[model samples]
Structures are given as C-alpha cells and as structure tokens.
Target: MRVLLTNDDGIQATGLHAMRRALLERVPGIELAVIAPDSNRSASARSITTRQPLAVDEVRFADGERGFATDGTPVDCVRFAVLGLVGEPPELIVSGINHGSNLGDDVTYSGTVAAAFEGALLGIPAIAVSQQAEHGRTDFRPRGRGWAYEDFAAGARFVAELVAAIDGLPLGERTVLNVNVPAGEVRGVRVCRLGRRIYRDELKLESVAPNGRKHYRIYGAEPGYHEEPGTDFEAVADSMIAVTPLGFDLNHERALAELGRVDLQAAFARSIERQELAHEG
Candidate 1:
C-alpha cells in the first residue's frame, strides 16, 4: 500500500529517517513518499500559508531517495502530497516517529499531531508517532534539533508494528491515532484519553534590543499535570506505549447541552437592530 510520510521535525530529521528505515525493514516492499517542511515547524499546528507563495524543493534521504521539502507547515506537506505533487492520495499518512512525546493538551499546539490531523481531515487514516522527549535531544527545536544524535531504533520498530496493527482496526473519519512510545522498551500498549498539561511560571524578559524589539524567554519551570485515570500521560509515565484516538472535531459536546440557556439568535438580532438605529440617526 502507498504511504505518505511527513513530520514537523523537518525533512532532514533523524526520527523521520529512522521511521522510514524501520518500516522498510519490517513491512518490506511498502511504498512511501516523504514530503516535509524544509526546516523545523514544531508547534505550528494546522496553519497553512496564505500571505506568500510556498516554495517546494527536492531533498535526499540517507539512501539517496528523493523527497519533497517545502517552506511551509506540516499540514502543507500533506496537502501538497495529496494534490498530486507527489502522485496520488496515499491510503495512509504516517506523521512523525517524532523526537518528542505529544502528550496531554500539547496536541492542540503540536505540529506533529497536526500533520496527521490534516490527513484525517482528507478522509484518510493517519498516525502520529512520538518517542518520549527525554529519550532525545530536542530541547530547543521541539523534535528536530538533535534527533540525529539520538537512537530511534526502538521507537521506530514500535511504530512499524503499530502501523501494521492499525491496518486492521481502522479508525473512523476525522480521527487519527496519537501514539507515544516510552523511552526504552514498551511494557504494553494502552488506549488512553488525552490528559492535561499546564506550563507553570511567568515569562522571563531575556533582553531588549536598542531598536525596542524586546526578546522574551518563557522558561519552563516545571510542567504540571492533573492525575487522571486512563490518560496518555499515565500510560507514558508507566513506561508503556500510549495510543490515544484524537478527533478533528473541536465541538464541546457536553457544553452543547446547555445551549438552550442562551438566546444567541436574539442577541445577534438585537445588536444588529441597535447598529441600524444608530446608523439611521
């Protein structure tokens, strides 16, 4: 089957390479097309470029296989690939084997997860695989800084197996598999719910330039978490692989139940009438 691969960690990242190698070794003869951002696009979410034209370039893998590199977001790579830039709409889109875990609420801002989200949006099954952050050296660039210096053999192997397993239990539309592997060997795989992560502390103003372009640093003091049952964080903390089914729909189902309490239609109508009255006056 044809598979499209991309990552927020950039086209040159080690995790991407490791994933490619592991899949080739384990799956054997599966076709893959790599299209990714030219540089690190971590935390970029599902943002697409509209202001300027995006540029695409051809890049090489370690094995000399050519891949497309674009000066755009991770989602852009998926969009371009599916639009016949790389050929056809792949049956599956595998994003990452990322250098860091996309646990808890971080998925809201994670470009790694966003790439898979885009694929799911296009009616294709997708997976966003990540290794624990501590296992790699991505302290600065999220998942792209120093992945080449770290060993992704174990994580990549886990992803290869996970991909095979997911082939059978295909997810519904608008959903993607959010997989996070432990640092070393995975004790087990647990289906989990998304957890909470709150970054504590104040923003540190690092420096102010003469031109008044102030530079600020938000140093992570310690990430805080809520202890919840069957969460991705709990699974990862227990050194097991965490597989969370994330959905693209952002509608708050529970809150929708209370929608009857507010008169949104009347509110808008009243505001519009008031504006019309003022305009006529």
Candidate 2:
C-alpha cells in the first residue's frame, strides 16, 4: 500500500524519522511518500497557506533517505501530495509520531491531528500519532541535547502494526483515528472518547516596545484534564495507547431537533415588522 507520511514536526524531527524506519521495517510491501513542513508548525491546527505560494524542496535525511519539505502547514502537505505531487493520491495518510501528546480538547489545536482530518476529508484513511512527554516536563521539545529516534520507537512500531492490519478494522471513510502513546512501557490499547480540558492559562503582559506594541502571554501554563472514566486522557495516564475515532461532522442532532420546534420564521417576520414601524414613525 502507498502511504503518505507527514507530520507537523519538520522533516528532520526524530519522531518522524522513527515512524519512517518502523514502516519500512514492519509493514510488508509498503511504499512511503514523506512530505512535511520545512520547520515546526506546532499548534497550527487545520490552517492552510493561502496568501503566498508554497515552495517544496527535496531534502536528504541523515540516513540518506530523500523526502519533500514544504513551506506550508501540515494540511498543505497532504493537499500537495493528493494534488499529483506524489504521482497519484495516496491510499492512506499517517501523520505524526508527534513531539507531544495531543489529548482532550487540545487536539483541536494540534497540527498533527489537523493533517489527519484533512486526509479524512479527502476520503482517505488517516491516523494521527502522538507521544506523551516525560514526567513534569511541560516543554515538549527534545530533552537536553536532543532525542534519539528510539525515544519514539514504541509508538512508531504500534502504528506500523495498525497500518498493516487496517483492512480488518472497522473505519468509516471520513473518520480519523487519533492515537496517543504513553511515555514508558505500554500497558495495552484502549478505544476511548475525548476528555474535557481544564485550562489554567493566565494572560500576562510581558513587555512594551518603544512603538507602543504590547507583548502578552496567554498559554503560559500547561492545561489539565478532567479525570473522567473511559477517556483518552485517562487511558494514557495508565500507560496505554489511546485511540479515539474522530469525525468532522459538527452538527448537534439533539439541538437540531429542539430548535426545529421553535418559531424562527415568525421571529424574523417580527424583526422586519419592527423595522418598518420605526421607519414610518
């Protein structure tokens, strides 16, 4: 199978390389097209480049593997591949082995998950993989000098196995599997729902420039999650891989049914009647 492997982390990121190595070793007869951002685009969400034209460069990895790097967001990488840059549309899209865990409500702000969403939007099966940070480490970046590819080996291996067995999995055409791997030993895998986040971020003014520009910090602290049962956060806390199926449908069916009974048309007519009465007076 042909898989489009991309990530929000740059092409040189250790996590991405670890996944690449795993796919090459574990998945039989798998072809990979690696395309990703030239630099880190973390927390970019589902954003695509519109104003400026994107540039793609052929980059050679330290292991002598060549891949494409673009000056665009993670979504753009998927679009770039589907739009014939990689010869044809890929059969699957695997994003990440990301630097940090994209859990709870925070997945909405993750470029890793956003890439998978784009692939699912295009009728392709997609998976977003993330690894939990070490204990008490809010800084999701590499520790000390840097992280070796082995730091992400466990997550990469699991994803490779999942990809190989995807034919037997019951996945919808427009569904994305959001996977989060624990830092230490793997307990097992759990299918769960998203947990709510309790944000403690405070807005603070850092400094004022001579040009009257103010610098403020809002997301200064790491957010916490509710300890709910059968949640993605809860599963990861117990050192298990959390797999949450995500869809793009944002409609609230219950609210739709309730609002359908309201007299919205009469309310609109009343507003128009009030405007006419005011004009005459």
Candidate 3:
C-alpha cells in the first residue's frame, strides 16, 4: 500500500521522522512519501497560501529517506500531495505523530488535524497522531540536542500498527481519526469523543515604540479537561491513547430538525410579494 505522511511540525521534526521509521518497521510492504512544512506551523489550522505562490525544497531525513519540504501550511502540504504533488494520490495519508497532543477543542486550531481533514476531503483514510507535550509528558533535552522523537517512539509505532490493522474499517465519508497518545508508557487505546479545552486568556500589550507601533501577544491557554466521561481528554488524562473520529461536515442535525417544525411557506410568499411590489414601484 502507498502511504503519504505529512505534519505541521516541518520536515525535520522528530515526530515526522519517527513516524517514517516506525511505519517502515510495522507496516510492511508500504511505500512512503513525506511532504510537510519547512518550519513549525503549530496552530496554522486549515489556512492555505493564496496571496503568493508556494515554494518546495527536497530534503533528506536522518536515515536518508528523502521528502519534500514546502513553504505552506499543513493543509497545503496535504492538498499538494494528494492532488498529485508526490506523483499520484496516495491510498492513505497519515498526518502527525505531532510534537503535542491535539485533543478536544484544540483540534479546531491544530494544523496536525487540518492535514488529516484535507486527506479526508480527498476521499482518503487519514490518521493524525499526537503525543502530549504538557503535564510533564514532553522530553525537552536542551536546545538542538536532537532527541525529541525518543520519548514518543512507542506511540509512533502504535500508530503505524493501527494504520495497518484498521485499513478496511468503516470510518464513514469525510472522516479522519485523531489520535492523541499520552507521554511515557501507554496503558491502552480507547475510542472517545472530543472534550472542552479551557484556558484563562488575556491580551497583553508589550510595548509602544517611538513610532507609536504597539506590540501585543496572544497567549494560548493549555488543555484543562473536566474529566468528562467518554472524552478524548479523559483518555489522555488516564495515560491511555485517545482516538476520536473527526468529520468535516458541520451541519447541525438538531437545529435542522427544529427548523423543520417551523412553517415558512407563508413567510417566504410574503417576502416575495414585497420584493415584487418594490420592483413594480
């Protein structure tokens, strides 16, 4: 099977490289190609380059596995690859093994999740894996020490096995699996729903220069799940892998049903009559 790997953490990110190695070990007989951002695109979400053209560069992983590094968002990388950037559309797209977990409402602002969304839109099965960075989960070994992927090696391997095992499972249309693995040794994997991520955010003004240009910082809050049952945050809190199926459709079924009860034929007819009268006058 052919697989396309991309991430929001850039081409040289440890998570991306670790995924490549783990997939090679577990998912046998699979062709792999990597296309990701040239730099960190943490919360870029689904933003794509439109004002200007994108740039691509050929890069090699630590093991010499070559890939493409693009100056675009995570979604841009997926669009380019699936739309024939890396030869033809790959059968599957595995995003991330990201540097941090994408849980609950955090998924909305996550480029890691956005890449998977793009894949799902292109009719491909996609999985996004993330390792928890907070709650003492991340391993920070100085600056440029180059051991970022070591801590989450096991999680990356698990993701690869999952991809092979769940190849033919029914995931519905325009759906992607968002997997969040807790740091350290994992206990088990659980299917769960998204949870709320709360934070105390405040706008901070840094300084004003002589030119009257003011600088401000938008600080992002951390994930604080209320330990809700059957939620992705709950699974991660318990040291288990959280797997949530995310879909692109945002239609509110409950609202649609409620609106069904309201009769609008007369309202529509009156609005049409008003328009016709205005035109006649």
Candidate 4:
C-alpha cells in the first residue's frame, strides 16, 4: 500500500523519525512518502495558508529516502503531498506519533489531527496517532518499554493490519481515526469518545514591557488527570490504546433546530444595518 506520513512535530523530531522507521520496518510492500512542516506547528488546527505563498523543498534522508518539507501548517503539508508533491494520491495518510497526546479537547486544537482531517477531506483514509507523556520532558527514550518507541511501532503495525482487513471502506466523507496510546505497557484497546480535561487557575498577569503595557502569559499549573469510565482519558490512564472515530462536520443539528425559533437571521441583518447607519453618522 502507498502510505503518506506526516506530523505536526517538525520533520527532524525524534518522534517523527521513530514512526517513519517503524512504518518501513513493520509494514511490508509499503511505498512511503513524507511531507511535514519545516518547524513545529503543534496546536494549529486545520489552518490553511492564504495570506502568503507556501514554500516547499525537497529533502533527502541519509539513507537516500526522499521527502518534502513545507513552511506551512500540517494541513498544508497534507494538501501539498496529495495535490502537488506526489505523482498520485496515497491510499492512506498517517499523521503523527506526535510528541504529546491529542485527546478530548486537544483534538480541536491539534495540528496532527488537522493533517488527518485534511487527508479525509480529499477522499483518503487517514489516522492520527499520538502518545501521552508528562509535559516538558523531551527525551522519551527512557520511557521505551511498554509505552515507548516499540509499543507505538506495534500500534502502527496493528492499524495497518486493521485497514487492510476492512474491505469496501468509505474513503471520503471526512472520516478519520484518532488514536492515542498511553505511556507504558498497554492494557488493551478501547473504542472511546472525547474525554474532559480540567485545568487549574494558571493564567497570570505578569509585568508589562518597555511601553508600560500590561502583559500576561498563560502558564500551566500541574496538570491533573481524571478518568471517566468510557472516555479516551480513562482508557489511556489504564494503559490502553484509545481509538476515537471522528468526523469533520462540526454542525450541531439539534442546536440548529432550537436556534431557528430566535429569528437570528433577521436580527443579524438589522444589527448590521444599524452598524452601517452609525458608521455613516
């Protein structure tokens, strides 16, 4: 199978390298191509380049493997790979083996998820893989046992196997799989939904700059973990691979029906007219 691999982490990240090596070693008869950001573009959420021209360059690995690097977000990398870089679209696009977990609300802001979303948008089957770890620590090599490189490699191989077995699969319609593996020996796999994350009061107003303007830096307090029974967070905390099926359409159909009673369209039109009249005055 032809596989296009990409990541939110920059092209040079250890995590990205690990995943690439794993795919090549584990999956047989696989044609691999990579297109990733030139630098880290984490938490960039499906954003596309419009204001500036995208720059893409050919990159060659030490083993003579060729890929492309782009000065854009992960979504842009996927688009470029499918439409511009590769001669043909890949059968599958796998994103990440990301440095951090993209669970629950994190998926809404994740560039890793966004890259997979872009692939799904273009009628390609895609999966986003992430590993949960303690924040700020760089080297995951020490954690390399049940929840380390080898474990993630095993998960990637399992996903490939699953895709191969499923026939007449729906490639289009923005279907994606978000997979998060716990850091350590995994218990098993769980089909889950988005989990909740609770953050303590970490936002603080620091000091101003030279111009005497007030500035604030949002610092994170110690992250706390809460596991609700059937959610992804619970599965991960139990050292299981959490797989959540996600769709790109964000519309809340029930809410649309409830909101229809408010005559919001006419209200918005009148509000715009009032603003225009005030501007003229």
Candidate 3: clashing pairs of residues: none
Error of 3 at 91 (Å): 0.8
Q: Name the top lDDT candidate.
A: 2
Model 4, span 13-117: residue lDDT tens: 666777787778767788888999999898789888999999988889877888889999999988887885887778888898887788877788889999988
lDDT for position 139 in model 1: 26
Task: Summarize candidate 2's per-residue lDDT along 1-281 as a digit string, tens digits.
Answer: 98999999888888999999999899999889999999999999999999999999999887788899999999999999999898888999999989888888988899999999999999999999998877433233434445667768889999999999988899987999999988878889999998888888898999999999999998757677788999988888888899999998989999999999999999999999999999999
**Window of ten residues with lowest summed lDDT in model 3:** 137-146
Best by TM-score: 2
lDDT tens digits, residues 1-281, model 1? 77888999888888898998887778755788999999988889889998999999988766878899999999989999889987777888899978778888878888999999999999889999887766422222243335453457777787787666666785788789998877755688899998888776578998999999998878656566787999988888887788999888988987897886788999999999999999999
Candidate 3 residue lDDT tens string, 157-275: 88888878866677898899999888766899999999886755668898999999999877743335555799988888788988899998999999999989987888899999999
- Model 4, C-alpha of 44: deviation from truth (Å): 1.3
> Distance (Å) between predicted and true CA of 47, model 3?
0.8
lDDT of each: 0.82, 0.90, 0.84, 0.77
Q: In candidate 1, which residue ranges exceed 4 Å CA deviation?
A: 135-150, 276-281
The collision pairs in model 2 are none
> What local lDDT does model 3 show for residue 101?
83
Residue 175, model 1: Cα distance from true site in angstroms: 1.4
Q: Point out where model 4 deviates above 4 Å.
A: 135-151, 166-172, 264-281
> 104, model 2: CA deviation in Å?
0.8
